[model samples]
Target chain A: MFAKRHVISMREFSREEIDSVLDLAESLEPYARGGGCDALSGKILALLFFEPSTRTRLSFETAMMRLGGKTLSLGPTEGSAMAKGESLADTIRVIGAYADALVIRHPKEGSARLASQFSPVPVLNAGDGAGHHPTQTLLDLYTIRKESRLEDLRIALVGDLKYGRTVHSLAYALALYGADITLVSPQTLEMPDRIKADLAGKGTMVRETHALEDVLGEVDVLYITRIQKERFPDPYEYQKVAKSYRIGAESLAGARDRLIIMHPLPRVDEIAPEVDETRHAVYFRQSFYGVPVRMALLKMLIGDRLE
Target chain B: MNDGEMKLRVTPIGNGTVIDHIPAGQALNVLKILGIDRTTQATISLLMNVSSRRSGRKDIVKVEDRELKEEEVNKISLIAPGATINIIRDRRVVDKYTVDMPDLIVGVLRCPNPSCISNTNEPINSRFIVKSKNPVILRCVYCEQAIAENIADYLI
Candidate 1:
């Protein structure tokens, strides 16, 4: 059912499909870690990053390499036709001709969805401007499934809930798995009303709070996101909230023994370095899981042709 | 006044279309959807808050020498879901039917989101998935932005 499909939004995925991807990722962990397979041997995966990204781009390349597939990249937009005012659709069309599937990260919201409509091959949205990053959500669910349990899981999504697409996608997917959600963010950066309404419509039990201390002891996973200064209209608001959202060693003192902290990283100190050595820090492992999760996604999307 | 006298308030069109049962206060919007401006060539009659047997009050539009296209009929459905179209030819009703609201409305309404791909110069027409018909809530296919209010303003 996944053949030649566009992975554009988490809303597009059913709970069963999400679990299936996570299950496939678990099975492919050995191949991802060991690094050799002929599953997608003859396929070509294209990487297009209109926005700068490290983990998403590399992990996709890593996933493709592990599956024994060749990968090509449109490295920097400055070096590509996009710098010369080539439209996203035009670029996607050109790239789609050369690859089996396309992994795109654009600063514009819905650009990935738009690219999918134009491209000949399947489009995997690495990240769009506060729109979606389904693979990240998938890998996140995978990490939570590995470290904790998804069934009746209590998760607190902290920091930048307003603009952080990671939490937005994760909240919906987590609800699908029947996890109760605690949204922890400053008033200005609280989760959007539309998303909360959507979750409520799905009958997901969600609690909203400004204090992380309120839910820390109860939640199985503490998901912290970087308060993106780039997304804020005013730098003062960013500065005010960024200073208040940090988590250090003392922050976890009241937390449960099995409480796992996850972040979609490029962290500018939302999570202090002191927390990294602790078993609670599953983010690095979370980042590593991006490989197998993406490998599963890539295989699911385009591997049928390889058969 | 009697029902026949009430119907005589708006003159009949010889060969055009009559839109009836529009929700009161939406006659201007229906006219806008039909692209009726001061420079419009077609002779038009608009009646707002007229008495209706089904609805308490309604609006009606009668256009002379002009028939609405399928696109216009669909746009009218967005603003006036209960409105019916009567095709007039030689002062007689040739065809009559209530406008059907399509599940997917394409290219007629613009997405309110400024950042939506449809709003950009992408060579793609805007598309919306009708989530609710009574209240006319539409979710943009490209950006998934749900537009619930003032939908007429977003009409392309």
Candidate 2:
């Protein structure tokens, strides 16, 4: 059961476990389309976002509510009991007794792992600095299947591959599914070495490029991510590489008409607003998949019975 | 010479090597990898989970007979670089030296990155560029993460 497990890295999920979630995702897609099912009745999800989150938190809360479940939210470290010098171990130890499962997001890289060590309930990683975000990757796999009708389609992951934990997780999963991926990011933001080797060894055709426009036409999915301006230690360094690449309305003209453009959302001009109206833009649907994917995850984890 | 739980128990071997000061729990893994554990006639005294005076806990494997191979010695130096080796004859220490890095490491060290092609499902022996021996750096052919040394719980 996911309730007893701790998700610190994407590697924690074996190929078989990912398939189980994918099967659940396929079965639960109808409920996402508003089908009749109370899969999460009598369950409670605990949200402990130690960092600020606009989309991730909302998606989990909505998923729980849609499943006829209740949630207890504790947002950001500044205002929470964590600011008062409470350790994550203590925080989760107390919260675990109340909530059946924990959806945790913290800035520390391995905060999710540390929380699960003490908590009696299962721990789900929302975002843990630049470490790993397994939940988002699951939704991404669902989105790719729903949008492209295949998992092995060519994808060009653009912008901030270094610090973008979402892309890191997604790339590993894509490699596992035998997808051809071209990583288009600045040299400084190139895909980490370990990730590149993993993909290439599995015979996934991967290339590193500084320009997204040069490789734009060859991809079935154009995954765009912001520069993660918030993660920079120096503001000027952030300013320099902030807008190195952008997937605007003009950029999509040359793309395959059926090509899907995805972002984890809350974009800062990396994707233009006009692009949202195009048939290619699937960020909203990308966001929507979060609910069912998470619901399917929660169901498989803590089960249908909400504690 | 005395076989104590924590001390490096040196046996009266006719001729052989004795590895001392290994961090507890690492000796068996090293011995297994070196094929010493599979010896049929050789008497093997493997003290494990033993407490260390320096490390708070450690282990020592004392072999009664049979000397380790030169390549095996080099591999240990390359992998378990911190371990000390002693060549003994007639129950007397003849030569003693710490394991040093080998010039060319074929399939010795496993890259710390799980996603590295070397660590994939395929039966591939990972080749290392071996950038820096001091602070070990290995560039993966498949991935960019040049794993730093000391990342492994046990090098062997």
i-RMSD of model 1 (Å, 1 decimal)? 1.1
Interface RMSD of 2: 12.8
Q: Which candidate is the best by lDDT?
A: 1
In candidate 2, what are the lDDT values of residues A80-125, reduced to their tens digit?
Answer: 7877877777888999999889999876555676677678988888
Off by over 4 Å in 2: A1-4, A33-36, A75-80, A228-244, A304-307, B1-147, B150-156
In candidate 2, how many Å is residue A154 off?
0.5
- Error at A147, model 1, angstroms: 1.2
Best by TM-score: 1
Best by DockQ: 1
lDDT of 1 at A127: 84
TM-score, each model? 0.91, 0.67
